[model samples]
Target: MNLIFHVRSERRVTFHPYSSLNDYIDHACCFHCRDGDWWLAKSLLTGDEGFIPCTFVAKAHSLEVERWFFKDLSRRETERLLVAPANKPGSFLIRESETTKGALSLSIRDLVAEEGDVVKHYKIRCLDNGGYYISPSITFSTLQELVKYYTRTADGLCQRLNAPCKAMLPQQPWAQDEWEIPRSTLKMMERLGAGQFGEVWMGYYKGRQKVAIKTLKEGTMEPAAFLQEANLMKKLKHDRLVHLHAVVTMEPILIVTEFMCNGCLLDFLKTEEGRKLKIPKLIDMSGQVAEGMAYIEGKNYIHRDLRAANILVNEMLHCKIADFGLARIIETEYKAQEGAKFPIKWTAPEAINYGTFTIKSDVWSFGILLTEIVTYGRIPYPGMTNPEVIRQLDQFYRMPCPEGCPEQLYDLMMGCWKEKPEERPTFEHLQHTLNDFFIATEGAYEMQP
Candidate 1:
């Protein structure tokens, strides 16, 4: 027989160019040749991005990489390299730009690297279902050459490369809307784990720095909620608050971002390995947290749920507060009116008793947090529930921060813990006070956590 046929898919059939068609399985770079009855196709459509080519070789192979080639990147062409559904540590890619035709070129690698300096090599993982990563060399010379070579290349080459070779999509916003992602981006979402909401994941935004995609978690909440928060967060520019990357509406949800790998402060503080909270680190992080809150407070934002869990810690042990889920503007008494429950001990006595919340209420909460720092995360009243904590608040229960913990911290905590709430220091005052205290202690205090 000249051809093999699926009795059902009898639509069309072609015979093999060679016997068995699978003999050269172990041969590397098999697709460029015709012997294997399979080939590597270049599609800008896959989640792996046009950063790498798709190897359709070794047909009938169960390896996820093999099946991926047959898929399409044409769907959701607007986003090529996804960032959400963050692939496994190893499942993604980055571009290897080289000089071709007196221009730079890029090749995908199997790892997202740590080095992105001019001479360093980097690997980036794809956010889609394709478990692919590109190990790219970060060479300034090569990157420059590629830019010179491809007049169309922008340092900010995003999903636009998948633009049809024939120029099928026009430049207008509406035209770009109907555009289909190229072959490379087609299979990007395949096998990708579902993201928080409709967020699509990608890497290398702004400066190719490692960052994370904040998407809406699927459930009863509308993806719009995430977008709303993302928008609000994007406008918030503070060194201490989590930096917002972009507020993109990927139809189903919005995306918020901050540097990747910097998990929340709770996870960070709990880790005992290779961690040293020099007084500087503590003061810096705590100070930043306070500064961030000050900024939010100026905008009338009340981070109703301020705690270690919402604050992120970078590699430098620098702190940046996040998670505005329970955050709100102080103009209204929304949650208070709804009788929504929140962390009890963290609540100001007024918020709990009088059902009133304001900037001062946030100040009171920060006081408890300052105490949490000295106590290393032990809640003020460890064994009490919200109702029980409320009882304690009524009695003006306060935790006596341990000795050997910085005395200035003790002073700050006590001031913020005042039951009257009016006695709590404002965020700005807290910042300046801490700064002065630290400068004076710089030459003194052993600086222990």
Candidate 2:
């Protein structure tokens, strides 16, 4: 397998694996993200006819090249990736037909190689409907060298993965000494939303793939705690949790994930009346949230940050739980003692004082999500501070459903906020109830109530 690396600078484009001179100059200049500033040219290797060339510049996306391309597959399946002779080592191939247009994703992963342990990764995606190219003769490189080439470039690169590129000269070939991706490279990384770790940016791994990169803060024991959460996310396999596409131990620490165009559910809730949603549609959307929550709880994981804002939607408005930085994995038979507390406004009363993290704690959070849906995505405790919300929880509190809130739905929320954890309904029960509630409130569907 052959892997091509692009060294972009204001001066010229450099080709690795030394392919044809014409193909080198003819950089298709494939750009990533929105601004149209990015571009990469691919060339078949001359030394090895099969491998192709693809470049990596910085962008708001694509920082997690390793995770975005290689982490999710089984070892056996990963080895099956038909790499071209010029591609990188330890990388796999993806057939175009395997993915969807709405979620155009491809990858190269599972490099067990060392530089003495250097693993080079490369990934490609065709812009138009022109089918994908899965080469067989690929080569390999190390992430260390790839990072060096990225830095020594010209004006650096621009963001906007989908941004149109200025047409470049036809094909040409050039090669230069290794360089670094640069300290300012952090400036080029795209913001990937936030979590307990801090804001994430899009970055590159082994000079390939478009991915959401997450960054966290520094403090005593913070790294250890962060890795614990990251490792847990790595081991998880539910469609509900925002997928941890890949994890890297790069110096400052970085995480890469699949980008979700719909932003977060908190943002979507603000537009409940938008064309993409109606009452029935909204209820169904909320149903997915419960389904995801139930899945996590089923695995004995407690989502401490269960709220509308923590939920995310993709281009199709499909809901997925996110921000596992505050999650806890409970043993199958685990049970907490008294005097434990979680998020009060979103937590069951029993959990607040007893430190109990039962599945019911999630149900309490789900109730708050219900109010968010009923109120067109309003915060559960509007105008209430953390202490104030806690004060209310101390009094057997529940946020009231809006004026036209359906009675059945109101009853369900009331059950969820019951002072005793045991009094809450299971997610499975609430899921069915929400469906029945939707059917009962069909008239409201048209009224936009």
Candidate 3:
């Protein structure tokens, strides 16, 4: 069975049987399967068949890709969809009729493939009018191509996919890489936290390896977006950054990472053990966060949301930056999203007024995080609503330095909250300053008579 798939990237495929000059220059082909590293298929565009590489294409989900023509369906609803347009059979009879625009939908769950001697199939359907149809018989692998055939012009689907011309994928396909641990290997344990995106659970991998399991909230996000974020997170590595161990995409999407025993920094600080932490210890925690931020800054990434609640602490008192679900990669700068939500209390003045976000804005949030640490998890801009905090900041009001916070550290916080983005210190500078404070405090303790 030949199922429809879409080209994810542009590539030059070779025609082995017919090696004419014309065929070599513009051989067009839709993907079939892995003939080792090459594709074996035919192209509807040129009626030419050839071998393209696996990197050029990906399977497209029918509902999402065929939005212009088809809708999702369950088996029970198929008859209803076909008969809905007509009060009786005579007026809108779509089956075996011609020269009419009566459209009908069908839901089918047919066995489509065999993987390692196991047959599998996906639920799919098509939409059709009495005369014309939108299905595999139309001879287009993607909706973009199908639309182009009808209109004799490019359509929005082509623009939306934005297939790159170059082979921009990583050398190793993510599925076959070392990190792709089988879903069977993970055992779900106690629930840790719950949020809009998903739930976090303490889990065990391979019976002994403890890990944090984050499952995507059902129907909350598209599979493609979730997988994209997972891919990005797996590429990043650092001692102070949460390490992704594996991802399970079989049924309920799950992301496994190092389990931070101490939980979020804010909650940890509120605990009895947290209350006993001295200033030097707090500084160390902040320093670890800065080191992580430094790595992210150097990589030209923006963590849009950076607050104490997003920082995870381990049993060793090590802080690791977590929750990159909202993270974005920016080359030089990024424009603000039209309706993006942000934590107002921790947000910088510029990020609030304008929609611009930069590493400097993250610096502003880090300053607020410092307050959370110093105050032993006190909420920033306490006693003020979100709008009130914005108004106060506009009037040059700042949070009072947390009690017992050293003068040097408070001054550093003030610098981070500067109105001008360029005036704020880079994470590298913040890390060094924190190290100095840590060293000075240690020396003073040692000098006590």
TM-score of each: 0.51, 0.53, 0.58
Show where candidate 3 strays beyond 4 Å: 1-182, 250-252, 438-449
Please identify model 2 stretches exceeding 4 Å from their true place: 1-188, 192-197, 202-208, 220-225, 271-276, 332-343, 435-449
Per-residue lDDT, model 2, residue 396, is 58
Which TM-score value belongs to model 2?
0.53
Global Cα RMSD, each model: 18.5, 17.7, 25.9
TM-score, cand. 1 vs. native = 0.51
Name the TM-score of candidate 3.
Answer: 0.58
Clashing pairs in 3: none
Clashes of each: 58, 66, 0
Which candidate leads the pack in TM-score?
A: 3
Q: After superposition, how far is residue 84 of candidate 3 from its true place, in Å?
A: 69
By lDDT, the candidates rank as: 3, 2, 1
